[model samples]
Target chain A: MSMLLLVRKETVSTRYKVVVCRDLGPDVMPLLRGKPELELVVWPEDRACDRRWLLENIHGAAGVIVMLTDKVSGSSLQVVSTMSVGYEHVDVNAVAKRGLKLGYTPDVLTDAVADLSVMLALMAGRNGGIGISVVQKGQWTEYPWAPFGFCGPQLSTTAASPTRKIGFIGFGRIAQATLARLVPFGITHCLYSSNPSSAPSSERDAQLAQKYNLQSVKRVDIDEVARESDVLFILAPGGSGTYHVVNETLLRKMKPTSILVNASRGTLVDSDALAKALREGWIWGAGIDVVEGEPQVSVDHPLVKEPKCVIVPHIASATLETRRDMATRAAQNLIAAILGGQMPAQVDLRGFA
Target chain B: MSMLLLVRKETVSTRYKVVVCRDLGPDVMPLLRGKPELELVVWPEDRACDRRWLLENIHGAAGVIVMLTDKVSGSSLQVVSTMSVGYEHVDVNAVAKRGLKLGYTPDVLTDAVADLSVMLALMAGRNGGIGISVVQKGQWTEYPWAPFGFCGPQLSTTAASPTRKIGFIGFGRIAQATLARLVPFGITHCLYSSNPSSAPSSERDAQLAQKYNLQSVKRVDIDEVARESDVLFILAPGGSGTYHVVNETLLRKMKPTSILVNASRGTLVDSDALAKALREGWIWGAGIDVVEGEPQVSVDHPLVKEPKCVIVPHIASATLETRRDMATRAAQNLIAAILGGQMPAQVDLRGFA
Candidate 1:
């Protein structure tokens, strides 16, 4: 049916134009192409959509689909879709005030991000960065065995560490999924600090604790989250409110044996402070996917050079499965909003404005 | 009580000495020191015990505690405790014929090895080696974001991939623990190939499936396991019988998108074959904590040079908690065997000889 309805350009081009900032790819492009009722203007590129071209072409379009950190200005858009879970929600409020409906690919990337989160935790906890460098530099041959060499704090529970406490700076879906992955590791207690605007959810916390058979899953203040957690995960959103939430003050309060992982936006953590923390042994180690001002991250970047910090390019949701799902979801979101139906993943911006 | 005992000299030194190949660290040395009844001669160096010194001092020892791959030739020992779970059990059989009581730290290192196994599966599946090198080499700056530049197979199950089939070469304690850890990743099916000498127990397999709520956990041939698994774990014992279990024929049968991880003995896997498979894209990637010849591994090693291979020095059980427990267990095992009573972790090598 989609093939038969392909590219039948109609009066909708004159009515409601949809400008896609980047080509969502063959699998998703087909979906966009099948929409005969809508005129599509998609940027044909292998890289990110060219900002100037996107902004110019998006003018007078009824809808637009773009990547993270992109904002639609000249477009008289009814809907905006981003292929990311995180965004500057300050722009969200501004968009909401303008009555522009937003669509985000959220639950799709949760598992991928959560999977990477646990990977980083294990890598950082086991001194993967340092160990890999030693092997790569051919130094493993010279310096090998010692009574306590290459030892780091074990992430899993053991006889020596029967009770495990895990904390999350932001207890969101991704954080919960990561917690689920660590269940068999025998983590006992969980404490988290969520957005201050959200109420402390005792009922939900109890449910979470019961779900994973944890000793306690409590919503505590940020200080308690820092002071007590054996493994702390930063899975919060990025914006002005959460900017540098894990600063030196919070990091200094953390257990020296603990590991800190930031799988969220880089702005949520202070890279210099985290580097300092790892250097000073305030925390055992850290694994971060997104560093503050990444892609621009050089070999000399403080976090990159830190032996205890396992820094990866912003590739948490870079799995082929997640990226494909994201593209399809973004296309579906745009198509749904254009044809006037219930969008699959429309963000609720009721309180934002 | 131990402090009061101190280091009282005993005439037992003339009758039966206790030779320790390596100083098992401060947390554990006290156990041996307090037992003044046993005259202890320990290797004072920080590295692995000097083989010559160990061999010379081990004569007529009542007990001996050593590391993996170490064997005593001229020692009259009642107990041989190794602070490792894996060994060349071929020697084990020869030692058993001499009625040598072998005690190894087993269950203590299972969780740590399992944790590293999962970490490897995640790392290899997500192209961690290539991604990390790119970042470390500063290539990440020039080549930032694309639609799917660094995309690899996602390890965790997703809506698009609701069914996951994980395979194991050897279904042992570490394999079971690794499976338990992967439960939350939505792996629906599991397949494994155990030792041909051991009978496949359907009852145990059924119990495991029921325990993890997996769709099925069945015992299959190595070829079938290789062909079907999305992620394959190598956790079998390393010895002559299991040497090169994952040869070219077995690897060629694996799925193109499959991931292979070796957290067990390196001898079980054919490194040259795996390097070929990865280079030719027979398998997506590999994560190996051990190699065929390690500690002597150079940057020129075929597996090490493979872009898709994530290699770490055999440090799967190299966590502080696990090491501490291993040391304590080794000390306890030696003490128990010498003093006469139940040994904590004596290996039952009845049929090996």
Candidate 2:
């Protein structure tokens, strides 16, 4: 039943020992089991890989398989294969400085993340949570359906408004993929912002605009992206330079008819500012998949309590197919790194250093 | 602020009386007010049109602007204009037998409904409500993010699985619109059922297949739709012939990974059968906007009680822009039918007879 690549022949006499932060599941674990050229040490629990166990096993290893939760550090570590798109949870500079090859699942999860981004935009535009609550909370019978009672801003273009604009904080693979999905919805214009450290892409922008038959797909300043967009997606990565990019000033510029979706990182957005924006109707609504202090959010959390805020736990990339692909890719990365001196998806670490 | 059509100029000796079920808000009411050619008698209550008030005011009316709930059956009524796409609540046969023109709003709400359909599919596929519960209930803290914590089915395809199949119960305008939206999601195959009363379109199917570069877009039967679709959308009309089309037998034939989304009428699906299927994992999940007896749903409702069921009160067409457009269309229909002798988008009721 394994679709995994067959283990290579002509192995070296000595088997290389590798530590896996957690079990890669039945679908992928068989790739490491009984391999003549590899020794696998996987965490034996159903939860996150314990830090102590990782620390103990990371030494004297040729390679390691990890999730975003597992930190990697060892003098003997040759490779660190993480099954997540973002490496913000891991110290990328340190990994590179230690001369370890880093393999991550990026492109494999892009479709899943982009799907969630579009879904979030639609949900937020409709004030979707309120409609869900009316049925879930047994208020449906208490109150009757009225004309224009639950109406929120429409996401699609109608005859009255034939052109719709969408913006992105980061114009990367996921953002472009999300834009591609919005084309059939009759999106006419696009605005996006890239990190100031990165160069502009007018040529690529022209190509994308022409491809989608959009009015314009321009690289603009963050202020313009915030102000002009009817729906804004924050797909930027997290770090100090981009931290709290969607703060008070940025929130103020967003239209009251617009929707905000954060499918990328938590720290890139300011929670309090967004909460205030929603409270004051600065924006129509927000669909948040990641919170600033996520996995620690409370029922009383400001964003959680906002009726218009449709918050999902950090599950943007959590799909059975995507997770399986990620795990399989991670396993393959580990196998390739240890046995063949190469990784299928080796993350370029030179830039981080 | 008025996009309402201008009143016609004709110096008539007498004005025709028209009764409106609900007050069309500021943007629309001006068109009806101060009209020398018409007298308006509207229900003053903010609730569903009071039946007694409507009946009392319906006598001798030239035309009536009614909501879906306000049924019309008056001897002197010449025209009935309802601001809803579905006229199932109104007796079309009776209206046609009485020789009254029926004007209803359609086409304008197509994009809004299609947008909701896609949203529901994504929500259902991701088990979207559970993720919301995890965050909204503050269980996020207790249950830390796991490798597969909230994993459900992925709506999009990846390299490993390039082709995805989508099914629709009805292949009408909204269904085609919904399919157009799914094109970018990498949906490779489409299966739909037009009413058996309608003719098959092999030519249209070929054209659609060529346009979308799909594997196949075939018109199939209900059994095939149930068995083959990874995500099945119920967008059919409501009537006895199609009632409970997705009953126990149809549900039992569906894939365990499939999602059922009902953005159309609820009666088309059997709630008990669907709940049972979900309970036994015969189908993955369901996203329902309309219930058999909606606006009467409670927490105790079988479908609502299902953990995988993402229910929204019947709001598939609820969008601020769409609602306004419908109201304006309805007003235009009433004005044209009474003053200018032509409704903008009149529904032909001859077929009902």
Candidate 3:
């Protein structure tokens, strides 16, 4: 019988296999060690997923745990699991047809993402980025105390009115958490537009609205969401289908004093369009956690150059406690799937299919 | 006719009759047009209460519209109707003895301060200082794509506890506005401590608390106030009696994960002590709008070096809308008092005496 093993020799030895397509924190290593009979092929080079290495090593593997950077396809691996909620990187239909179980970390990260969503919302509302840039660029002394200087939209209970509605571009788990934080700030209405077929359950939406005493929690058109919202939060996934959901046209519909917060993927927004929007006053301001072509952004980046925009380096789920929990959970999900058991948590593929 | 004109001649005669102690922007000057009987002393420098200038222009004036910087002493001038709520700078005992009807701008600044109190509380809880510093410092290179790096306490209601307990160091008008914001945050309790002689009316607190359905609207000892607060807000006036009220002893009594917001005054907190507490984990974090020695803080300031501390340059009443309102109200207060009418708004100092 054939078995899988990391080959120092040309021939494989007898060991059940799990392939880690990317390097995780060291805390995740022991989850594999718990099974003495299984072998783990972990990518030594910590980087964007090495396609060649993954293609070669993922052959005949029982399971593979991957990150967003990795593309898990039929040509690469089966029994795919991801460390994030969105499984856009993995070909879910291929996995289903191959009879491979798909594992992913979901509810475990709701609190962390929720925390960041609120942070970004507040940061955008407070003009924090402009204040920081002013200090960093040595503009503090040049600027004296002026009445209108450094004033951003004040997030308050007083902001709750019929005209100024709270909008969500894609209302998901983290969006709900953000709403919980916003509820206290006196937002009484909500408008959201998600994947047409993958909308939230009526019962769940009803419960959320009732719990917060909101006026309504119904789905609306994208343009309507933008037009009505005083603050539009983009909390959806990033993929080809949903790329650049918030373009210049949608942004122009927002109120002049409105704010935009993007704690999701950078590709969900077009940076150039957003930069133009900020410069031309299409929207009042934005707090962006994820930026297109980020981690490579220079001081002169278009969005960075805009005084009205606040850019954070994709830190939505980066709490110390939450990171450790994600690492541990991702490790457990991989281990459970390889050891003749159901995945600890698996992504539901019905919607994706 | 030897009336003590608190107005300076050289500066006041050139501009308007009232020497606006602090710089009120140009919009205010138009309100005093053609009031030839009244001379306005404008301070070219922001150091409005300069002793040399005050002594030189101390004779023959009807009214004065001063700011927090001016010290209206018996030796200097008699009638001081300041444009700010706090009259600690004015030698009130001397004013009382000299029979000067002191006017102050109190109610005008309540909303601004209260708005900032909540802003500081939210900023402190979210580690806004760290997030702000990180991006401006260009520290996004070393560990990019981090899932859990910068996270702080998020203020929200959960299933475990639907209500937040907001405690006030001083139950004044600003404190009540702060409480109003917390009400929508599912806050059900409001505990406060005020100077025994000037405590807020129990009937007013009860009625306001009942309007919001708060659990209790009771005055508590300082120790209990410190202990019970999830977000302890310091809104008390700055003076010797309330100095360093949140010292190590009180900080020790607070929850480790709790946040402290001081929009009131820097003198209310011990900066060095607060820095130590933040470093040694005595308390979670602090946000200060004012510091002990403000406008003189350098990069090496002790609180500036503390990561958890969010220090703003004393901007509690710094909103555009509020500032304009304050300037207009201050000028009106001076105009009204000088015309032998009641001050537009006055702080009753009888209780303090």
Comparing 2 and 3 on lDDT, the stronger one: 2
- Tell me the fnat of candidate 3: 0.15
Q: Pick the candidate with the highest DockQ.
A: 2
Instruction: Output the better candidate (1/2) by DockQ.
Output: 2
Q: Of the candidates shown, which would achieve the greatest lDDT relative to the real structure?
A: 2
Q: Worst 10-residue stretch by lDDT in candidate 3 chain A?
A: A155-164
Q: Write the per-residue lDDT of candidate 3 for residues B1-353, one digit (tens) a residue.
A: 68886975444343224555556677776665445546677666644356666545554555566766566443434357776777777777667766666777787667667766776676677666776566545665543553344655545544344566788998888898878766655577888898988745789878987888888888989999888888899999888888899898888898887888898877899888888888887777887777776555666667777888876655667654556667777777777666556667865557434
lDDT (CA) per prediction: 0.87, 0.88, 0.71
Instruction: Give residue B343's lDDT in candidate 1 (0 to 100).
Output: 78
Better of 1 and 2 by lDDT: 2
Q: What is the DockQ score, from 0 to 1, of model 2?
A: 0.71
Q: Candidate 2 DockQ category?
A: medium
Better of 2 and 3 by TM-score: 2
Once fitted onto the true fold, the runs of candidate 1 whose alpha carbons sit more than 4 angstroms away are: A1-15, B1-15
Q: What share of the true interface contacts does each candidate keep?
A: 0.68, 0.74, 0.15
Clashing pairs in 2: none
Deviation in Å, model 2, residue A288 alpha carbon:
1.3
The digit string of per-residue lDDT tens for model 1 on A1-353 reads: 35565664355444468888777777788988877777888778666677788778887888888887456665488888888887573278778889988888999999999999999999999988888878887778765655477899988899778999999988889999999999999999999999889887899889989988999999999999999999999999898889999999999999999999998998999889999999999999999888888778888988888889998888899998999999898888888887888888998998887
- Residue clash pairs of candidate 1: none
